[model samples]
Target: MTHKIAILGASGYTGAELVRLIATHPEMEIVALAAERKAGMEMRDVFPHLRHLDLPTLVKIGEIDFSTVDLCFCALPHKTSQEVISALPADLKIVDLSADFRLRDPEAYETWYGNPHSAIEMQKEAVYGLTEFYRDQIKNARLVAGTGCNAATGQFALRPLIEADVIDLDEIIMDLKCGVSGAGRALKENLLHAELAEGYHAYAVGGTHRHLGEFDQEFSAIAGREVKIQFTPHLLPTNRGILATCYVKGDAQVIHKAFENAYADEPFIELLPLGQAPSTKHIRGSNFCHIGVVADRIEGRTIVVAALDNLTKGSSGQALQNANLMLGVEETTGLMLAPLFP
Candidate 1:
């Protein structure tokens, strides 16, 4: 069964990525493309890299007939996503890539996003789209909220340890480095080639980054208590990938065993051998996440490293994975491509 799909915000990086991946998907077909600003233009005109394929010309969100779309991937900006998704057909399944529906509490959403959620009722029903942890829920969900790239990477490193009680909760600290693509395709003075190249710097220091809300909500729920970890993210000069180095107090071997056990049956997650580490280069442009663990010289302290393309496993690839489940197709159908290596 070919599931008809529409991609809103078709001009953005994630939108183009969805097009690229779905173009090869066996059970999914892109039927419509929407971009408010790029309306009436072909997707290839906006992203020449996609010029090879034939796709519907971009249109305004309101112009598309959602009744015909089996599922929609909303890659729009946060506030915009809520308004657009709220107005979408009630029965239409959705996978939202924005931060709009990620936090369950409206107040928490306001506190982090600085705006009260405009679609509270819809937010309540949106399943968190962390596919590995919420597979069953995603399969049945009418709406799924994709996690922040950084949040997803961090959780992959720590969630298993937290669930197994193998790590010290209070001492957990994650220092992550992300490529500029995670910031989105929007233009920023800081993201310019001259300004960002040949350098790397940290932002959202001192627990100020918005993704902390997701980390707080998810980790707290898992541990059955308030779990706050020191999280600081750095902006790298590259165009893809995320490398998260996590520090936890635990036995290295035990933590390694815990991850191996948790992800043993999972397809996209790769747990490396003990004392080894993964690099962003290995998983670039792929829907795979590589995790590795190493013991610190100090007893009872361990280090965990995780890597993936911020735009793939971190966003579009994840959306497609969930869409597969929702459509009753194999979860790994379109996501089996190998990581691009140099």
Candidate 2:
């Protein structure tokens, strides 16, 4: 029952993370690794931390025989993901960790990503991979689009509220903080140790961040109207996790009850006791999300905080969770590893 897996973009942060998780999966095996730039090198050579396991040498995407791969984890860059996935076998099951397939409308995709989607027909078939909310769809999907880490974190805090009509959709505000690794493993001057260390700053201010497209899509769909939250993301100095602090107009006790009821049967989503907040340190390197709710001093206002490993529950771990459903295997398999903490 082992699923033969191929990881495209194997040298990136999310790609290496897939390798780390799959190494321990009881029913999935990595049969190929593709990183066009890193072709002809061993995965361990590119990521020494992975030196402990035996894996295929990195190869260009064109060199792999997709016909043999039971499932593929497309961890490539956004535009690149659509281009590569468009040409793969039609029947190949895929979990895409890119923004490419996440938004359903090609026009909206172009509006946010600045280019027309290259694979329109494929977009039509792609299911949004917000595991908890779309479990049934994911189980039957051939292609699942993983959500942005920030989007995932925010939705965990607010989706239930929106669904229950317990919060005012008009006044939602999400101030999120994300670790640098969420930016990907690509080298950039801003991400340089000297520049990023000791200082924290916010980017994509004023509703320009692309993850807004996701928020717009999901929230609007849930509220049955155009729901846009004031979202501002700050870059953290560390290497993992996302903390989304959301402000909403709602009854505090009702908000807490809504979340507790919504996630009561879910495995990965944890609802903390009232007045207690979750920290990124608590969920590092684990496929778990901790959500906390607290009432503001002002009546009818609530603050919801959600924390998760940006690389794990935020990205790679999410991809694997959808892959499990698509493969008809236990959804929690190979993903119960505890969070790493000091």
Candidate 3:
């Protein structure tokens, strides 16, 4: 059965990535595209790369008929996602690519997001959309919240270690770097070509990045206690990809074994051989995440790294993965495309 899919905030990078992936999905069709600011323009006008496809014209969210859509991919901004999704039809399955519903606690949401969740009821029902960890839950969920690109990359490298009791939870440190596209299609002085093209710098230092809310939620849940990690993110000048290096107190062989055993047969997650690390370029434009493990100079410490395309596995591709499960279709369908390499 072909599912009718709608993308809200189609003018953004993540939305265009969704269109790029869904254009090849055998069981899904793009039926509606919404971009409030670019509402009257054709999708081709907003993204010339998508000019070849026969896609729906861009419209405001209010102009679309939700009843005909099987699922909706919400790629709107953080605070705006909650408002837009709150007004959507109740029966529609939603995959929100925003921070609006990621944190389970409403108080934490307000603290980090700077506003009370507008859709409290929906927030309560939204499933965290980390495809590997929450596969079963996502399959039956009505609303799925896609993770932050940085958070997803960090978790991929460390979740298994925490689960297997192989790492010191208190000492986990993640230093991540992401490309400019992860910043979205917004215009800012810092994101200008002249400013960002040849430099790299870290932001959200001192454990202040909002995606920490997700790291806190998932890690605490897995360890059955509070697990906080030191996280810092840097912006790179490239177009896409995230490389997260996680430092932990653990035995190298044990850490490798834990991740290898956990993702032995997973579709989108690939565990590289010991001492062989993964690069962001290897997973570009695909929904695959590659994780590697190596021993640190210290006897009882290990370094784990994970890489993936922030726009694909980190956002839109992840949204589609969850949507497939929610719709009872094969989880890996249309998502098995090989990563692009230089």
Candidate 4:
């Protein structure tokens, strides 16, 4: 019952993470590794840390025989993934880690990503890959769209509140800080060590971030109305993790109870005790999300904070979780590795 897996765009951080996790999976085997830019090179050549394992040589996506791959993890860039995935066999189960099939509406996709979705039919069929909330859907889906790291962090803190109607919807605000690796492995002048270290600043202020689309869509769907929150994300100097502090007008105890009750059966979500707060360092390099809730100093207000590794639980790990459901394998397989702690 072993499932053959293929990882497209295997040279990036998230792709490498998939390799690291899949290497230990008992029921899954990596049969194809595709990295168009790094084609003909061994994965060990691109990532020396992986030099010890015998891995498939990196090839272009078009060169792989999809019929032999039971499932594929698409970790390519935003628009690039849609084009590559569209060409993949329709029967192949896929877990896409890019922004391609996340937004269901093609207009919303075009509005936020600035282009029409190339795979409209496939987009319509793809299920949202929020494991805890969409388990059944993911299990039967031909394609699952992995959420944005920032979006997933925010939702982990707020989804329960929205579903329970325990918060004032109009007053919801999320302030998030993310490590630089969430921006991707691509070289950017701003991401240089000298420029990013020692200073942290906010970008995508005033609802300008693309992940806001997910917050709006999911929140609105849950509440059965238009739900828009003020979302601001900051780029921190570190290499991993995302911390989202969500502000809401509600009872702190009630919010805590809601999260605790909602995540009681979830394996990867840990709801901290009341008045405690989560830190990014605690869940670094793990497929775990820690959430904490506290009463704000102001009356009728509460703060919910969530922490998770952007590359692991936030992306590739999530892709693997969804793929497990699709393939009828144990959801926690290969994902139970403990968080890296100092």
Candidate 5:
């Protein structure tokens, strides 16, 4: 029962990651790969790290025959994903790794992304792709929307406490540090070696980062009320991880207990010891999220920190996990690789 998989935007970082993970997948095979500008080039040529993989030559999205592809992973840019996905076969299953279909409301999408969504019907139909929380929904979904790397890391830190009512909703603050790879492979003046090699700095401050929409939407839905959280993200000098430190008003022990209970059965979520903290180095290049909780020096203040590879657990790895569920395959297949440690 091998499922035929297709990848769009194959030249991008996330798309190449999907190809890397699926190359070892037991029940999945790459049938076709599409890239707008990289079409006619071999994947191994575009990404030399993938030279060992015998993947198909990249083609334009319109050139591939979707009927032969059991599932497609769209790793294109935001607005581009909506347009491309809208034109895909109506019944073809899809896992979109862009900001396009994540926000359910067209107005909310416009507010966050500054563009009205082109696929309203598909947007409403797409399930959120946070695999642990949205497993059941993803298994039956025709389309799945992958979460923002920052959003996913923050949610992992706060979702349990929010669900348990153990934290002060109004006082929540998430300060995250992410590796530059989360920015995609696109060239940018800020991402140059000279600029990013020596230091790191915060970019999205004061809730201006778009992922806040997800935090607001998901956190609000879980608490059954409007929950506005202060989120600030920093870009680190490294290449592939996200470390989020969350501040909240709560009992540290109680928060630990809540996290333990919630993530006990979740395979990819690793809850650390009480008063301990996690570093992105431990979970790099894997589909595992390490969480730690410690009490702040101030009374009633607790800190929760979470770490995961932004491209793995945060994006491509998550897309594969959802695809497994949607295809009725074992959810953890080809995704149980251990985190790379130094």
Candidate 6:
């Protein structure tokens, strides 16, 4: 019953996370690990913490035998993901952890990513990979596109509100803070230990963050009209998790009730009591999302906060969740790992 899996871009943080999660999975096994630049190297040498697990040496994407891979997790960077995925076996099951296929419209993809999408046909067929809401779609999908960690965090806070019309959609504002690991393992001047240790600054201000494409697509589709949210993201000094605080015009108690009704049966979504909020530490290294609601002094204002590990629930864990569904396994199988508490 073991599903043979291949991980492209295995040297990256998300890719390594896939390896860590699969190492213990009863129904899935890592058969090939691909890293373009790190090809010909041992996976354990690329990620020391994973030295205990015996894994295949890193190879280039071109070197993987897709016919033997039950599913492939693409953790490559943006433009590269589309080019590589387009060249992959068209019938291969793929769970993409990149931004390439998340946006449906080729024009929208180019607008946000600054390049024309090279795989529009596949983009049209890829299902959005928010496991809680897209369960049915993912179970039948050959390709699933993982959402932005920030986008996933914010949506977990607000989607129910919008669906039930409990909040004023036009006044929605999401102020999110993300761990440095969400930036990926790429070398950057701002990500240097010296530069990031005490630094907390907002980037992609004024709706420039590409995840807006997701927020707009999902929210608008649900509301049956154009819905735009004010979203601003900040960089945290830490290495994991995302905290998204949403400010909205709504009846506080009713919105809390909405979350209760929406996630009452969802395995990974946790609803905290009124006046409480979640911390990123509580959900780190796990596929759980904790949401809390607080009422503002103003009669019609409510603040909803959500927390999850950027590397787990936000990306790689999400990919694995979709893969399980695609493989006809239980939705929560191989993903019941407890959150790492400090």
Q: Candidate 3's residue-wise lDDT over 1-342, tens digit each?
A: 999999999999999999999999999999999999999999898999999999999999999999999999999998999888889998899999999999999999999989987888998899999999999999999999999999899988988888999988889889999999998898989999999888899999998889999999999999999999999999999999999999999999999999879999899999999988899989999999999998999999988999999999999999999999999999999899998868
Residue 121 in model 1: lDDT: 92
Clashing pairs in 3: none
Which pairs clash inside model 1?
none
- Candidate 6 Cα RMSD after full superposition onto the native fold (Å): 0.7
Write candidate 5's Cα lDDT for 85-157 as tens digits.
9998999999999999999878999999998888898888999999999999999999999999999999999
Model 5 whole-model lDDT (C-alpha atoms):
0.94
- Let me know the TM-score candidate 3 reaches against the reference structure: 0.99
lDDT of 4 by residue, 1-342 (tens): 999999999999999999999998999999999999999999999999999889999998889999999999999999998889889997999999999999998999999999988989888899999999999999999999999999999999999999999999999888999999999999999999999999999998887799989998999999999999998899999999999999999999989999978999999999999999999889988899999999999999999999999999999999999999999999999999988887
Q: How many clashing residue pairs, candidate 6? A: 0
lDDT tens readout by residue for model 1, 1-342: 889999999899999999999999988899999999889999889999999999999999889988899999999998888998988999999999999999999999999999988999998799999999999999999999999999999999999999999999999999999999999998999999999999999999999999999999999999999999999999999999999999999999999999988999999999999989999999988999999999999999999999989899999999999999999999999899998878
All predictions: root-mean-square deviation over Cα?
0.6, 0.6, 0.8, 0.7, 0.7, 0.7
**Model 6 scores what on Cα lDDT?**
0.94
Q: What lDDT score belongs to each candidate, Candidate 1 first?
A: 0.95, 0.95, 0.93, 0.94, 0.94, 0.94
Which residue window of length 10 is worst by lDDT in model 4? Answer: 204-213
Residue-level error in angstroms, candidate 5, position 235: 0.6
Give candidate 1's TM-score.
0.99
